[model samples]
Target: MTPASLTDLKAPAKLNLFLHVTGRRADGYHLLQSVFVPIDWCDTLHLHLRTDGQITRHDLTATLPPEDLCLKAARLLQQHSGTSLGADVHIDKQVPWGAGLGGGSSDAATVLKGLNTLWGLHWPTERLAELAVQLGADVPFFIHGRPAWVEGVGEQITPIELPQALFDTPVAVLKPPVAIPTPAIFGSENLRRDEKPAIVADFLAAPKQFGCNNLEEPAKAYSQEVVQALEWMQARFGNSRMTGSGSAVFAWVDTLSHQRQPFTPADVGVSDLTQTGPWVGRMCRLIRQA
Candidate 1:
């Protein structure tokens, strides 16, 4: 017999206002300070409760693990509260993985949040946030789903309200055919690690406080195919930037009248996502598609 019922959930993507690596710990944890802003685009996660004490997952889209952070999040919550109920997880993914959009982290955070409700754990957001950090550095920000000033390896967070108009501007998400691994980019000795840190209060006060991703340059160099994708997006829209590491770049377009959901349209001639060279991406307005 199941102890509880099922519920639905949404996991959104995030953009970093700016990422700064202040220092590195002896244990190899890179301390950081960045402002996280949740855009309307997201991945959908559905959860069903179970009585048999089993936790399983089904990905409706591509197969991914991102080091199994989603599963780890559920296990962490269960261990922390000692909840007996289990969850059958279904991920209806739209957020592109390794796109510097915080998709995986958001998915993990959702599990933490969803299970808390499904199992009747009754943990507050603050408590759930602490548990999220154990799963990943970016998990806490998604729990709040607000623009935030992040510090201390992204564990420390101060939420802020961004102008809703950012979404009004249509943004195009362009993913190159390749994947840029986060670990590899961060591990490179040439990657900049000397930037100073900032306080949360001041950063939120001015959202565009600093420049874009510090990892963008090196990341593109590592993935030449991503450079092509960036070029395509820029050709169609105005200004563009590479999010997070690399392999995915985005641009701002004013109108997305044709798209039911906000999206950057595909390359007219390109259909295959793995062609690796020049593929047309889609055009969508800035809204949470998943």
Candidate 2:
């Protein structure tokens, strides 16, 4: 049975602990090896079922495009399931766009999972995850809903149990006013296409030492803002690195100090803030999935 209302469902952001571009497929997809962990920082989604069979959206924040991933996910699910039911999707977005934190993908995944419950679909996660793969590379990871070692253009997933020390580690995620394009980073000649895959045991043995992002160099080159943000985090906290393809970087901090300061363009001149600071960030804890 469908719920009367599904409101304020969270779509959490994910950090790629280490991103290694191992090889390229003939179809131009980049094969990768990375550890993806969900953080507490999240976007909020509210859903109300519609009987008219028309999916629509209401933006609590004007930041997203009209045809964003959430809308696409809803449409895809409706089409695939042949459901006459629809949804009025309302989004209160928190995750930054194009930061490589997989915000869009997470939103889509949340929609898929939430709708499965709200629409009375009763589909298993494995089946929903298969549908999620069509939306984006990172969508399936969110559907899988756990810390995992991700591979094969983000399709293959192996669940990993993190140590308690690393599981509750505090992280400072900082994003400068910039967006790093994934295509540009992958297309760059400087990108390393060959990195020996590390075993899970090695990473488990020394998670801190194993944490690194291969996309960092290209991302830094793409935006000076990314460089400054990374440097700032590095100076404040040790073991700093870019998360995904770029624009946002994070560092493992022993203690988290939550302070919201307005970010000015004079900081980098790349900010897109109309009101809120163009530079957005958060201090989050990695909560291990049961």
Candidate 3:
């Protein structure tokens, strides 16, 4: 057995704080505005640099593929920069797929960052962001690795420093037992594409009630039952929205928030469907150690 010379990177999950489909382009691309924040929840990646040209991956998640966008980004950078080293990658997964949390995109960005340092490419952030956009619309923001308000196919990003210390709120992420095909949600006739734009200051001022995910209607139309989860989440907390597309929903509430009344116990249990593969996950607040 040989030790894998690797660098560990945190591939964090992201939520589209709110999504608005401003317009559809001639090429069928949707213009939109939203806030994207990387939560503590994440997938883990370990990259072991190989002197030879060996781009390999050991994926532990059921939904993700070995040759996913992460590896693609690495290869793409290697080709563009002419990096001489290759690497073996391993992932210990926790983020759910098809839930619009940007788990995959984050992993891809982590790879780009890792390889840039491991191979001594020293590519600038602007160069990496450009390459990321070539990979996926959500790719560039992950490299930014900060809370941002995104627009225009998610490529346009402006990082906002969250008041993490000032407003210490608890987050609850619920992934229902379903896998949503993003294309299906986009192509579905019932998708809602209408939402008036708002000033960015409106979001920063009162993020709890600035906007909502316009992609929700179409996502529910395809899945046909997430409405219940959406309703439940909203009823439980003041701030709730469908993150990205479908299947996963999240709420923001105080950690000590009363979940049930003294006289009656409220039903807080989300539905769990026993799909062949893993389905339904509850993400607890990932505490950071000083």
Candidate 4:
């Protein structure tokens, strides 16, 4: 008989308010500075703990590979903690893959956090975050569980609190029927590897225009879909920018009302999400940091 019941958890998506590649490490990893915020678009995770020491996945989408990040997270935690327990992971993926929305990294972070409790490890989040970085550049941010100022190849995180009005600022997110390969974007000859580092105070002073994404030119060169998405948002929402590397763009909505839910289509100038054919449109808000 199974000793534990199944648990359902959320793995939320994130948006990069601004991403700047300041330089490259001697080892070739790009150094970055950015503000990362969590959005309402999330993937659901169902986990069942097992004493049998066999990690498995019941994938709802065939698009995910057998060696996806979430499974890797579970195994990594199991090995480190020296826990004899394993997990059966079921994923209901909603965040579009390869869109620079940090879906896979978030999934991995959720798995690591979840397993710590389910396995009775009670490890501190700081320790978990240290482990998470090995999974991906974005994984530690999710484990930090806050909107953050990220630097140092995404290993350094500083949590920042935003005014509630910023949270009230509505956002519209759109993904074209395409994906951007992060490695290709990073490796492009056109990529900018030298931008002056930004100060948090300066960013807070003019939240919208602190740093430009160094990856946009290279990303747009490869994906016309990214160009189309940005153009569409700029036409409607007045100002638009690609979230991370490319393929998904977000625009600020001028209209603001108190919204009980994270997503409200009316807040984003969209009357309905279902009508946005071939484009995945979602209304989202910046979650309060942490």
TM-score for predicted model 4 compared with the true structure:
0.91
**Candidate 2 accuracy as TM-score:** 0.91
Residue-wise C-alpha lDDT for candidate 2, range 14-103, written one tens digit per residue? 998888888889999988999999998898999998888988888835666788888999999999999999988887888888899999
TM-score list, all predictions: 0.83, 0.91, 0.87, 0.91
- Candidate 1 lDDT over 1-290, as tens digits, reads 33354555778877665777778888888877776767666677888888777888866434564337888898888888987878888888777777788888999988888888889888998999888878778888888767677787778887655555555665667776567788988887657877766665565454433456667767877877666666666665545677666656766565455233544336422344455544325453433222
Q: Give residue 180's error in model 1 in angstroms.
A: 1.4
Per-residue C-alpha lDDT of model 4 across residues 1-290, encoded as one tens digit per residue? 33364566778888888899999989999999999999878888888888899999888466677888988999999999999999888888889887888988998999898888888889999999989988988999999878999999999999987657667787788887678888999999889899999999988887766677788888888887677777767876688888888778887776444233453334444344335435677888777642
> Which model is ahead, 2 or 3, in terms of TM-score?
2
Superposition error at 58 for model 1 (Å): 2.9
Question: How many clashes in each candidate?
Answer: 18, 0, 0, 0
- What does the lDDT read for residue 50 in candidate 3? 90
Query: Model 3 off-target regions past 4 Å?
Result: 1-4, 60-62, 164-167, 258-267, 271-279, 283-290
Question: What value does the lDDT take at residue 64 in candidate 1?
Answer: 66
Better of 3 and 4 by lDDT: 4
Off by over 4 Å in 4: 1-3, 256-277
Off by over 4 Å in 1: 1-3, 60-62, 65-67, 196-210, 254-274, 277-290
